[model samples]
Target chain A: MQQSNVYIVTFSVILTVVLGLLLSGTSQVLGPIQKKAVELDTKKQILGAVLEASELSKMSGEEVFAYYDKRISSKVVNIKGEEVEKDEDGIAIIPENVDIGRNYKRKPEDRLYPVFMFLAENGEDVESFIIPVYGAGLWDAIWGYVALETDLTTIKGVTFAHASETPGLGARITDASVQARFQGKRIFDESGELQSVNMQKGEGRDYSDDAHKVDGLSGATITAVGVNNMLKAYMSHYSAYIQKRRSGESGGMAVLN
Target chain B: MSTETAQVTEVKKPAEALLSKRRKKLLSDPLVDDNPITIQVLGICSALAVTTQLQPTFVMALSVIFVMVFANLTISLLRNTIPSRVRIIVQLAVIASLVTLVNEVLKAFAYDMYKELSVFVGLIITNCIVMGRLEAYALGNKPYDSVLDGFGSALGYAWIILAVAFFRELWGSGSVFGVPVFDQISGLFGDDFSLATNGLMVSPVGAFIILGLIIWVQRTKTGYVEH
Candidate 1:
């Protein structure tokens, strides 16, 4: 059958309009659910950095959210460690809303850093602080949460996730064994300088004994370096806060909430 | 008249006409002889990527099946009206719409699987099998036959992926559908059955090897040779 130019044009236009409407409608209906999924996923990852993987995996969605709501408090702070106040409308500026992905584009001094405080059993004692870090891996983006101990110097735990890192190699950062190495490693040296944790190449050296070094993935040197750089860059953003906490100037972990 | 006689024959045996020998072939041929994945080697990317684990592989297969059948039926129904000059775009529009709907539904209902599959679910738009069947069978066939062909080819693609996933997940993670089978074996054998998983099985290389072997075995058994 011969199709005239007019017929083709009309048909194409109608088809495009119908398809566009269908897709947009689907997106509109599912957008909220997808947003909730994303929020839950972020909360779960934040919890994963502090809690055991097995423990985190066992919790239901409601349980994860409830735990997050009850125990974790977030605050947005400037580069100088001062809290960023709410806008003129009095709506509190939530730290969770401060996306680090976008912060990468802004100047260091202008960036608003978020700090997630994990409260202990007493609800007053700050157990650990979790910071989100992300950087480019060998292939794509690699991101993670690093939880600092109450002292604000030692690493409590960490959870690494990646976009498209090489599976069985760089992707092993997501493995529990690799992340476990960061536990108890000091982010600050003996001289009270922020060193961050380095993902060193090779094995046999005791990662636990080194205050500022963790075992890197065997075949993923570029990714390991990427992780090292990400940690250094992100952790430095909280240097003022960490220093203030270390000085005991706020009378031993003041409750921010 | 000939038209009156044709109407009488068509109405006389509707059931027989529905399940004719040719119709059966349309549904069955793609399962073996004209398999889209095994024989034609279409859509190898997702097959290799998602087969690293069974759960994601299963979800991916189902998504492909859904897209294929719906896209085929839509195209077939509009075959005559669709301008030949812009038929490919029309097919693409139908397929993309179905895929986006599937993706949204998955995000709402199966969020975990959606996250695991991630971009792969989006990549279904680019899957050759869906487009190939649309062009080769749907454009020229009736709606019912196009649906059958789409279903058959999807099955052909699915089984290969599922088989690859079975081996990969079993040996790679010592699990099936996330259940640790080897751990159970170890429990039964009282620690003597400790099995170290093959890391290669979790990588793309394992999928390549498994698919290659499957094609080889299938060809040998079917006695089909590429000339």
Candidate 2:
């Protein structure tokens, strides 16, 4: 090969080989950090479901951890309203990043855990907690953690999130303002049958403000309607557990209605 | 005996060698004339997917540029030694390594964007830009020319895709990077003015329309007809 050819060819071979190794090796080094980022984001989402983002934002990370530690206590409960072994039973294991279908298959009798958060709202000393709910959305499953007020109906606040939905449309299921509307909304009628809140289109009409309505995504009727339907599904399934807690049968920790 | 014959053959240019002018055409013409994918109808899948957002388009452009430049240079360097029987296998080996590196880097520093990019980031392995550069130019040219050729075609492809994404994000959501712009127009028109754009803008259908408009503009500007 000529002088110019040898210089460029040898340089090209060495450059490609060395650079490719470096790029691949560097990514492998960064994998753990990236994975940790994903885990932290997931933890934040779970925490947000129970606490208001505005309130959570007010506290530093350490303060938030301390607050959650003191305010929230978790216990495993049986189908018969009795406390199960702390180490055993179904455990309501929400797989950190897995889908609802897999998470749902862990039977209630296997052991479902309930967590209570003690706080005060509207001049009333209150105990609030979150219950996990799952249902279908427009293109996939819709799931959320709903934080309930002492009455176990009015939403204190909510944080909803989803996967693979249209960006500005179905994705609004996770938006802040939409979640705020669920606040002060009742989940059941006086008779104790599940009457979940409605998400209505156009200028929202608050049914009674306390047991009322939320404004639906204007152009995303299907996704809006999915959320409303799923709310009913969550409310009805969890009503039995809520009923026992309401009767003060699970101690005075939670008052349903 | 074999060594003497090899030494005798080393001094002469092969009769079958592609001339300099033709090699220049192979490198330069993809940007305008005889484009491998766009004009010649090759790798349209990526053209539709990543063009919905500018950031992804930028990443895709970077990936394509790296792959094209390196794939061409590597192929050109190995052109003399590679056996005719195994040349395609060798080409794939080089392309695959470049793509894996692209995936790994994106996965490392830009994890969120990498997740959003998903399979498309990995799909650069199959993107014909790498293959076309290898076969049409790299297999015969010197390494320097191959590198420039790779850069030229990748840029040619990127310019069109980024321009398409620019309009898609701007008109689709009336926002850039999720910040609501076009707020003035929306406010003036009231409810009649919709800044909350059609989700279709991010969808594949939007990409098709934008690409067509681009090709139409490019054609009109160049007065070229595709048969």
Candidate 3:
């Protein structure tokens, strides 16, 4: 049978319209579930950075959500460490909704940074603060959260995830052993200057005595440097808030705790 | 008279029509002798990439089977209407839409596996076997036959991948389906009975070597020789 130009055009248009409708309808129905999945995943990652390993492993999804609700408080702040109460239009801002990736494209002063405060079991005192940090790895984006002790200078824990780093080398950043090395590292010097954390190169180099350095991944120098830069860039943004807290001028701390 | 004859033909035994000898061949051949991955060497990229673990590999196989059957049936039904000049585009539209649906469903129900599989789920649109079968068989066959062919090819691809994953996970991690088999054995045989995992088996290179051996053994058993 002959297929004329008009026949081809009509067939193509109909096929395209039907497919577009089917795809859009599926997305519409599943959109909310996908959003929930993303939100839950973010909460899990945040908890992974601060919670005890034994406790985290035993908790289910509902328990994690309940824990998050009962113990975690978040607030949005700008680069100057001032809490942001509202946007330009006077609408209250939710810090958990602030996407770091999108905010990364904006100027540092204009970016909304989210800080998660982990409360003690009694919910009166702050236990730790988790700050999300992300930057480019060897191949693609690498991201993680760093949890700091109440002093806001000593590292309590850290967790890392990557998009497409080398499977055995750079991707090992997500390994528990690699992340455990960050424990006990201090981000501030004795004089109270922000030093962040350095990922030092060379194998078998003891960083036990160095409060500001951790051993780098064995075969991933570039990714290690990326992690170092990410930590410095993000930690510096929180320096003002940390300094204020250290000086006993905790007026701007979120009252929710 | 013509209406009465059509009715008689429709009333014939439905079982024979569903599982005729020719249809049985369509559903069974690809499991071994006419395997898509081993015999035709189609869709080897996913075969090598996702076979490092049994769980992900199993989910991937199910996803492929779903996409293949649906894509084949849809394409076969529209074969007559599709213009030769734009058939490839039409086929791609159908396959991509199905892959997207599968991805969304996976994200909703099995979020962790979905994350682990990641881009590979989206990569189904380019798996070659799905497109090849649609082009070669579905375009010229009835919808029922095309569906059978889809199932056969998917089974062929699934079994090979599952076999590869079994060996990879066992030798590489000393486990099966995430259970520490070797750890259990060592516990039973005292502390000295240790089995060091082969790191190479956990890598993509291991998948290649395992798949290559599978293809060789399968071909020899089936007495199939390449020209």
Candidate 4:
């Protein structure tokens, strides 16, 4: 009911200046700590998916780096079976801030060295190059790394994670139990055609079906279909690389593990 | 002008007599007695939406407390000059600006948690808990008392939310902070892992059930009059 011009002007200026100071000050102080946290967390996720949490936890981050270093080799191979980046480092760099509109789109330029984690007995190493697959899930996008033997046929290991999904239903993709089913499964049929893992339905999946089929998710069928679709989409895009690896080409899809 | 003159004179009485003892009422009142969400039934949407989990609920409560305390203090400081015709707008501008600061800090530092919260944090600008403090208590008090009033209102909102998140995470997934509270048989779930959900902890609707159950418990513990 009351009014004063002096108070109005002073309040606006005071609030604006105080807020400006607070916003800038807090970010300047907290920005780097947040960035480092994110970087470390990503390392944890990559390690967790490739190695058992119990095993990975036993090793320090440097040891994990050393494991990936000794076993994982980064390659920037093009679709034409040519090495894109080859030097002493053996690390292929993927550009950041990729804009694919939706996380499900194919922005082919975003391809680079896919990180591969190999697990075989000592000295034998792994004989496959693994690649990361990004696809749509039930409530959000899902991503996983799929490793292949040097032949690009048999699967080595698969790790998956989701951004947003129903915890009990669609979120099953992140469940280690669900993802573990993907391990040791063959990704190709006897004829050498791509037969990526399947999410089985009601009852149980007969992994020994006449056809090469992994069990599909039953309760969350749509999310299962999403994983199937994304798996196909990723395989198709890199068909050339897959074909090259299958044909025993040496330049692309070299064994890291 | 006459009304202004009369009100000014009225305000000059012993500080105790000029303002009603709204302090003792608001301070101790909301914390337990006349709690907003649990007791009075206000601002339950955010209490449910953000409290489906723990970490975000904690952050949301702190943000509301900060916003409320400052908004209340500022609004009270300018109580004498706020134009009657545009009072709500004035209160809103103060709240909105503070909320923006909160948003930026969350984005720059807690970006991941901020993404998890998504639009809910921005929606804080509309929270009745903050607005109610500004309009009801801050509009007529000294700055310090108004700040205290805001803090009390926020404390009321926080406890209810924490309780909601605790139960939701505990029963829905049978876990706390992502650690499994329930065990699974080996090789039953996937990759030789079997974890159970207890099946009830997955949706926002589930949050409502848990919240209602909590409200029932609180009501039985503390009887109140219909005001």
Best by DockQ: 1
Backbone clash numbers for all candidates listed: 0, 4, 0, 10
Candidate 4 residue pairs in backbone clash: A125-A257, A126-A257, A127-A150, A177-B190, A199-A215, A199-A216, A199-A217, A200-A215, A200-A216, B172-B201
Q: What class would a CAPRI assessor give candidate 1's docking?
A: acceptable
| Candidate 3 residue-wise lDDT, A1-257, digit = tens | 55789988999899889988998898899899888877778898899898766678688877888999888988888887888989889999887778888888887778888899998999778899999998889998899999999878999999999987766678879888889999999998998888989888855588999999999887789999999998998899778767666665366546534
Off by over 4 Å in 3: A87-91, A202-209, A249-257, B1-17, B172-174, B180-199
Q: lDDT (0-100) at residue A237 of candidate 1?
A: 84
> lDDT tens digits, residues A114-180, model 4?
4344545463555565666787787778777676665676665667767777677777777667777
DockQ of all candidates, in order?
0.48, 0.16, 0.38, 0.32
Candidate 4, position B182, lDDT: 52
TM-score of chain B of each: 0.92, 0.81, 0.92, 0.82
| True contacts recovered per prediction | 0.73, 0.22, 0.53, 0.38
Score every model by TM-score.
0.90, 0.71, 0.88, 0.76
lDDT by residue (tens digit), candidate 1, B54-102: 9999999999999999999998788778877677888888988898898
What RMSD does model 2 have? 7.7
- Per-residue alpha-carbon lDDT of candidate 3 for residues B1-227, written as tens digits (9 for 90 to 100): 11111222234354567788989999899999889999999889998888878999999999999999999999878876778777888889999999999999999878888898999999989999999999888877768889999998998999999999999989887889979898998899898889877878878999999999998998788899988
What is the DockQ score, from 0 to 1, of model 1?
Answer: 0.48
Q: What are the C-alpha RMSDs, in order, of all predicted structures?
A: 4.1, 7.7, 4.5, 6.0
Q: How good is the docking of model 4, by CAPRI class? A: acceptable
Better of 3 and 4 by DockQ: 3
